[model samples]
Each structure stands twice: as C-alpha cells, then as structure tokens.
Target: MRIGQPGRPLDARKDELILQAGRELLLRGGPLALTMEAVARASGVSKATLYRRWPHREALLEALVLREAQPLLSMLEGTPTDDAGLAAKLEAFLDSMLALMGQPGYRAYLQAIVALPQQQADLQRIWWLGPHQTMESVAALLRRYAAAQGRRWPAAARDAETLIGMAIGLEQARILYRQRPWRADARLRRRLIRAVVASFLGRRSAGIAVCEGNVGRG
Candidate 1:
C-alpha cells in the first residue's frame, strides 16, 4: 500500500512539522543543507511522505516563501478606497517586506542565491519567479490608487518593481553590506516608504507634463 493511502486524510500536524523542519534547516544551513534526507530526518517523517508533498527542493523552498508571504499578500489583496488608505497599505506592505529581509536566515538565503555562479539557472529563476506574483499584486494596488484619483500612471507594474527593488537595495546596503546595526525604527521605515512613493509620484507627474506639452505642440 502507498505510504499515504489514497483515501486517507492528510495530517495537518505532519505538514506543519515538515514545513517547520524545512524552515529550520534552511535558516541554519542555507539551501545546500536542506536535502530531502535531512528534512525527513529532522521532521521525523518518511522520505516518501516528504516527496508526496513536495516533489523537489525548489518546490519546498517556494512553498516556504509563499507561506511567509501570506500576511503581506493578504494586505495587498485588500481594497484601499482613498489616497490615504492606499498609501497606508503600501507602507504596511513595504514594512512587512523589510521585516522579512531583516531576518538573518532569510537574508542569508537571498544573498547566497544572488552570489551563486552565473551558470546556475536556478538562482536567476528563483529570483525572478519568487516575487513575480507579489509584485503584480502590488502593481494592481497602485493602479487602483491612481484610478481613484482619476489619473492613470503609466508603467504601474514597472513602478511596483522599482519600489520593491529600492527597499531591498536599502536593506542590503545598510544592514547586509555595511554590517551596520539594523535599526528599523518607525521613522526610518516611514522615510523609506515616503521616498518610494514620492519618487513614483514625481515620475508620474513629469510624464503627464511631457505628454501635455507634446499635445499642445501638436
């Protein structure tokens, strides 16, 4: 008989154990240490069961990130009725992302992935795919915010990417590269969020002005 029977209900407890084991292994020893054997041993689950849930290591890692991203994703899924509401939600999302990046284990994992040899397609693939959906959701939020003001921001999706990239870059520069004490005080977080929002709005206004000038010339 199959280890997990066809009709048998899956155990939530076992799934949590497996995920928890995977997370601990990842945080403790990077991706290289998170082999199927290690996870199975750590979680005290049979290899067959682990394989039954996650076919490969990448799949398991992706699941872990997705789980971690749920709260931020939930906020993105919300509807913000006004400029203030959108700005508040965006700030919350950025704060959440910064918090995730601030985690030593998570930061190490991202840095390790980035430092991998160019020949490793997995690194590039993960980097692109890991945050693609969340960025899209963010773009949707930005678009909604602009629409509410009766102004269309061209390249909302690109702007979303830029906002996230800026946050990550700031964290890397201050906390990771400089090895400075990471102080995510409320004031700093607010400043970062404001910078991103202001930059986007500035570019958006400039674009509108340029278009208007061209229309006048025509």
Candidate 2:
C-alpha cells in the first residue's frame, strides 16, 4: 500500500508493479540495466506514471529495496516456540537468508545501493530502515522464542546478535573478497541451530565461546 510520508497518495498497484519490474530488471542484468523506460515496458505501465510516483532513480531503487525486504518480513510473521518446531523454523530462516544473500540478485542489489549518490537522508534511511530494521526483526524473534522456552533474552542476546553478525559478515566476505560458493550444508546448518539453542540454555557444549569478562561472545 502507498503509505506516503509527505506527498500525495500514490497508486499502490502501480507502485507495486513498478517495483516488481525494477527488481526483475536488476536481477537479470544488474543495476546498469535498470532504466525507467525498461521498467515501464516490462510492467506495461506508462513512464509518466512511474515518474509521478518516484520522480528520480534513487527513489525507485529505495522502493525496490522495500519490496525486497517484504518477503523477508513475511517469513518471520509466524514462528513456533517448541524446541523441535523452533529449530526447524530457525533453520529454514537461516537457509533461506543464506541463499537469498548469496544470490547474484542480492549482490547486485547491494552494489546498486552502495553506488547511489551520497545524500544524507537517503544514507540514514539505508542504514536505519534497511539493515537495522531487518536486524531488529530477527532479534525480536529470538527474544520471543527464548522467553517462550523459559529463558531470559538479555542473558543470550549478545551471543545471538554476534551470531547474526557472523553469518552476515561471512556472507559479505563471500560477495566482496572471496568468490567461493556459500555452502549451506545440512550438518552445518543443524549445528548452528543447535548452537543457538545451547547458548540460550547456558550449556558450554562443543562450540567456540570467547568469554569477554563474564560475557560470552560467540
């Protein structure tokens, strides 16, 4: 829906189609191929309609980012709390996130975002709304699941954030420095899922736990 921040209401259906077209073009040929005319052609919408809504390339890209984040948000809408159910849900999330982040489409999206002109408001929103919002959603889910299992969130919150950071960093390295394929092996994913549970349970099982003065940063 068109939740206009400060402007007149825009057509939600048209906005959705434009964003879908932009993402398709971006994933297919990277950022260079994303043009207003191409998107209009792909979406069967007029160029005037898109310009009236977006008015610029950067706005269109930001809209696409919101579109991309929608599916991720939906994935966390309903999560289970039981051990087995939670583990399954977490594994699914991790695997899906890994695959999505590792894809060429995602890499292209990141590249486009980084290359955008350095405007203060846009950069701030990119940081706060984009990545920070996504991280907060994940943290909330972890906190909820932990509480449901009769555990304190703050007790394991640090490790949980650190683990998420590790996963994100590993994926970033694969995209930036290393060209190696991301291996989401079943055994490794299962290990990560168990490690998350064990950390919350305060078990010092067979895993790396760097204790930083009473705080375990995994």
Candidate 3:
C-alpha cells in the first residue's frame, strides 16, 4: 500500500495546494518551470508529500491540466435534440475551447507535450484525452443533428475534425504566427464562433470565412 493508496486516502487540501502551485508555476514560466521541487516550495508541501502524489513533473502537470479540462468536457454532456439545442452544444464546445486557449499556460502545456520524448508516449496520450474526447462528442452531435434533418453526413467525423482544427488555428495563430491571439477582442471571437456554428449547421453566415469541403483537410 502506498501513502495515498485506497487504504490511506489522500488529503484534498494538499492536492489543491499542489495543483494551484503547479498552475502558477507552469503559467509563470511554462512547463520547464514546473519542477516538483519548485512546487514543493510554492505549495508549502514537503518534497516527500509531493512525490507521493505524483512521481514526476510530467505527472504533476498532467493532473493540473486535466482538472481544468474537466469543465470543458462536461460542457458537451446532456441531450441536444433540436437544431437550437445542437447549436447550443456546438457553441458551448467552442466557448469552452476559447476559455482553454485564452490561458497562456495552455499553449505552454502544448509545447511541453510536443517536446516529450518519443518513449514518454503516455504523457502525450493522457493529455490528449480532452481534445480527442471532445472531438468524439462533436462528431456524435453532428451525426445526431444530420439524422434529424433527414440527411446522411458520411463526413460528420471528418467535419468535426475540421471544426476542431479551425478552432485551434483560430486561437493558436498568435503562437504559430506573430498575429493576434483570441483575446484581441470579444467582438472578433463572437464573430468567429458564430461563423463556426453557422458553418457546421450548414447555414452560411455573412462574409465570414467558412471551412469549405476538404479544402484544408490534411
């Protein structure tokens, strides 16, 4: 039995403290800054206690990210049985992603995952569950909406992927390029989100760039 095993439940207070420290450190200096030793000092928890919770910095970072990611995943739950309802779900999906991408730390987290050693596959796989699961939900929602409209969308899965990619490109433009990030303004974001929702529902919006059929599919 380990220190925080089933026989010995872990302390919630300590977990919160550690994760808070981890978030602060990661955001302040990116993934390279979030060392267990640094977390121990910032969190006021001993190194031994920290290690007992997470074996390494990667594990600690994973815990910190997943905690925040849960809310995003939860936004897709429940039945959206109508066009309005489905649009709401898709809007929620985009909104949740916007919230996540708004965090500078998230981009840092993405960099860290990309830099992981090829042998360290587990970290990348675990961290990706958020986006992957959300994609699954988006695909499911698209399928349901299409079926209700008496049509077959064989490309629902592909379209869902495209939507997610576009959202990422929208937010990550500042990082990938020197252009403006999502926080540029509220109006721009709303316009982009509305365009995305409109496109996915097959109703074109005014003058907004819509993702055409397999145009950027790679």
Q: Which candidate ranks first by lDDT, i.e. highest?
A: 1
The residue-by-residue lDDT of candidate 1 on 57-102, one tens digit each, is 7888777767766788888876677756776787788888777766
Ranking by lDDT: 1, 3, 2
In candidate 1, stretches whose alpha carbon ends up further than 4 angstroms from where it belongs are 1-10, 148-151, 165-169, 181-183, 191-218
* lDDT of candidate 1 at residue 90, scale 0 to 100: 78
Q: Is candidate 1 or candidate 3 better by lDDT?
A: 1
Q: 1-218 in candidate 2: lDDT tens per residue?
A: 44344564457766767887888987766555678889999988898888988898778867776666666656655646665665555555656666676675666666765676656455665566556666677677766776675654563446545656645556576776547645445566556645654453344222223222345533
Number of clashes in every candidate structure?
0, 0, 0
Query: What clash pairs does model 2 have?
Result: none
lDDT of 3 by residue, 86-118 (tens): 777777778768766776566666676567567
RMSD of each: 5.2, 7.3, 7.2
The per-model lDDT (C-alpha) reads 0.74, 0.64, 0.70
Q: Using TM-score as the measure, what is the rank order of every candidate, best first? A: 1, 3, 2
